[model samples]
Target: MNILIKSATLPDGTRADLAIADGVFVESAGSGATVIDADGLQALPGLVDLHTHLREPGFEQSETVLTGSRAAAAGGFTAVFAMANTSPVQDTAGVVEQVWSLGEQHGYVTVRPIGAVTIGLAGERLSEIGAMARSRAAVRVFSDDGKCVHDALLMRRALEYVSTFDGVVAQHAQEPRLTEGAQMNEGPLASELGLAGWPAVAEESIIARDVLLADAVGARLHVCHVSTAGSVEIVRWAKARGIQVTAEVTPHHLLLTEQLASGYDARFKVNPPLRRDEDVAALRAALADGTIDIVATDHAPHPVESKEAAWAEASFGMVGLESALSVVQSAMVDTGLLGWSDVARVLSSAPAAIGRLAGYDTPFAVGAPAHLTLVDPSARSVFSVDHLHGRSVNSPYLGRELPGRVVTTIHRGVPTVLDGVLRDPQEVSRG
Candidate 1:
């Protein structure tokens, strides 16, 4: 399908009437192409998610790659890097390549499978990073996400080993000792609620140490789901000292606070947990000034049974794919700290850069891959879990109001979502 995006401005302060033909952006339009009016919408290269949990090849009861890709399209994401924490753990080249094949079979969005840093994410032994890298999947990012790589010597070797292949270690930065049995962020709230205390130092200490280690080994480091003010300081300090480190803040962490734990709702039970309002303020400022490199949804999905259990026994996640773009649009754009271009940068450009997908976040320009999102920034909508395209409905933002709905999503010049509904990817065959 051919696409025509009208009245969109590029981040470099230039405006264009973008045209796509046969899966590539063209300088000029052909007369036979189908055209969609994009008068009030801001068009950008499609969004890329650096962190997502699409539980397939095992946990399909929670989510599959197809369903998660639909959720991603609905959320204005053109591509997503599936995390290594799947049922079989995505540690081997076979598993990683299978995931890449599944993404192709679905063909809704690009799915880059992240290789597990340690076997089964066990942390004691390193996985076949070399084999995974050399596989057809060509996994470029490795992480022990959902579990911190606690051993410093092991982490150093993993970092050094991946450096040979130009890969970065995405750290989940949490000290196991400091967060054992921890339910929420440690402080007044944990005390008042009588929940296990997860102190900020648990996260900050890991980040502080990892950045220094990255500097020592001359390797790149990426921090995932940064949740504390001190962690922000660590990333800032590392960057100032010319260390190669990048950080991402979750949309929920930027918007919500630890006070939500007072309700004892399992929906608010995230891995890092909600933090203080002061930290929220600090995160917002950091994102505004580029201290935070990007905003990742973390987009974890769990079944209803897992979330409906007692607060302490519940799962550690909430679905954010469908709500991410709108929340970022509302919080960042509405506040005037960022514009539509900045939204594309955080949600699309920078994420692709971090994940090392060359064409994933290309601009809507000539010869670029026609991966794009058309968003009506003025559109306001009420959040309803049932309306989300994902199989899971664990979003904490349910019932909340947000602005800027993604009206259309074009992947590889094909309209995967039209008028805010998912199109059958297989129905539209490739040329």
Candidate 2:
């Protein structure tokens, strides 16, 4: 396979043609080589998702590795770190290996499985983290997502346990005590709506405790979906104190607020819940000034029936893979808080570095993996379900107008998406 992307803006502020051969990027092409005009599009490093629940190995009705990877490709992602909170939980070497192998079988993008922090994500005991890490899957990021590892002593032990192998625990920071029976952010909105109060302190306290614990244990800590301004303050303080803690704010948290859920729709019900506009501004500033290291889509996919229920009865997530970049481009780029390089850094590079993945986040140069996203920022678009590739139509941004469509996405020099359409996986896979 060979392609010459003509006259695209490179990350280094130069416009040049990128030539690819057999899925590995070759040098610039000579005159009259088989080429596709980028029409002066801004070529970017392919996006990476640090947190995504593919829902395969269980809950196939919601998604499979095939459909999820297809969704990822359509979303301009070259790789996604699959969350371990599956049916059985990716707590063992066998399960992680199976998920990894299935990703290869699909051959659309890299699907790295996260290992559960405790048995079955129960938080009862330390999972076989070392064993899972030692497997062919080489799981490095462990999490008890969808459930916080709230036991202080156990969390301390888990933090120390992963340190021996350079593993980092990605915690879903919420104090079970504070969030017990809670549905939305604790505020007047909850009072008016007659919903349970999931307080900001629920998130802040866990982040504070984990930061202290990480400081005490000298291990790395990652706060998943840091929502509240209080939580942001904690992360900001931790980083200033050199506490070795990093935080990520989802695209929803950066854009939407509790007001969206006033409709009482299930799609707006996400864990850590949508926060206030001030927190959203703070998070965007944090991303700009390096307070938040990555902007990952907590791309949780829920089945239609599960999400289409009453707000409280429905699942606490929304499919984000397909809409993440557009949301960022609309909310961040359109607002002047971020540039194209900053976009790549947060969406592609920083997340890969934090998640400890392989072969992603590379600069576009000779000998680098040819993962790329060709963007048409001038392209006006709408979030139509007909254009969505994910099995679940649970994205919160449906019917919203947005900018920056991904016209072409190349994974390892092969076009998984050409002209904004998902190509046949078999045609793109390396033989």
Candidate 3:
């Protein structure tokens, strides 16, 4: 599919014409090209998500690779790293390869399978990391995301094992002991609501321990869903010490607070539960100053029954892939804390670098793969379930008004979404 986009604003705020041909950017679209007038739209490098839960090979009721890929494309992402906590757990080479093959077959977005740090995520023994790394999937990131790698020795061993293959361990920094039976962020609010508190130290302590372990072994470490101010400070300190660590903050953590839990709305409930307003402020500041590496959608989706239960019995996640960019724009860009270039960095290139996915270093370069999204920044509307393209509508931004709308998203030279509408899956597959 050949495409020519005219008058689109680049990340650096420059207006230019972009021509795509044969799955790569070219000097011209040549003959019989589809021309799109991109006036008043921003053309950004395709976004990449480091943390996403596509529950396939087991829990299709929640989300499948194809449905999740459609959600990702609707949200302006061209690639996403599927978490390891699937039904069967993505621990072995065969499972990872299966996921890779599914992504290829669907062709909605690049689905890079994240291998598990421990077998079945039990945290007892290390999984077949080497085989998965060398498999067709070539898994570069291993994690026990839904559960923390709480054992220090096991954590160290996992880090060392992945470092041998130049892979990084993305840790879910939650101390199991401190967060047992916890429901919301630990504070006065939790006490008043008669719920167990998930203390900040639970997250901070694990991070503090892992950064030192990573330093001792000289292995790369990545922290997932950092939600507190203390966690931010610890990551900042680690980076200052020149430790090889990268951290991600989810969109919910940046824009929402634990106060929303007062209503017992399970949609606001998430792992490493939302913290105080001060923590949100600190997270925004850290992201602006580069203390936080990137914005990742911990895009967890669950069935209506799972989320409609009591607060304590409800699932710990929110569907985020459909609302990540709008939330980022509201929390970071609209606040003057970040620019479009910074957005491109946090949402695209930086995450691609972390996952070791290439073709993003020189965005929109001639002959580069045509992976990009066109967004209308001036558009504003109340977010509703209609915006969600996934199977489950468990989003937290349902009634909120958000800035920016994805106008068109092209992945590998094919239009997954165009003119603000998601293309039919069969059409995308054919293209």
Give the candidate number with the greatest TM-score. Answer: 3
Which portions of model 3 show Cα errors greater than 4 Å? 425-431
Per-residue lDDT of model 3, residues 403-425, tens digit only: 99999999988888999999864
Clashing pairs in 1: none
Best by lDDT: 3
Number of clashes in every candidate structure?
Answer: 0, 0, 0
Error of 2 at 389 (Å): 0.8
lDDT for model 3: 0.94
Model 2 C-alpha lDDT per residue in residues 337-375, reported as the tens digit of each score: 998889899999888888787666466667878888898
Ordered from best to worst lDDT, the candidate numbers read 3, 1, 2
Relative to the true structure, how large is the alpha-carbon lDDT of every model? 0.88, 0.87, 0.94
Instruction: Show model 2 residue runs off by greater than 4 Å.
Output: 29-34, 429-431
Q: For candidate 2, list the clashing residue pairs, or say none.
A: none
In TM-score terms, candidate 2 sits at: 0.97
**For each candidate, what TM-score against the reference?**
0.97, 0.97, 0.99
* Poorest lDDT segment (10 consecutive residues) of candidate 1: 7-16
lDDT (Cα, tens digit) per residue for candidate 1, span 122-206: 9889999999999988888899889999899999998999889889899999999999999998898788988998999999999
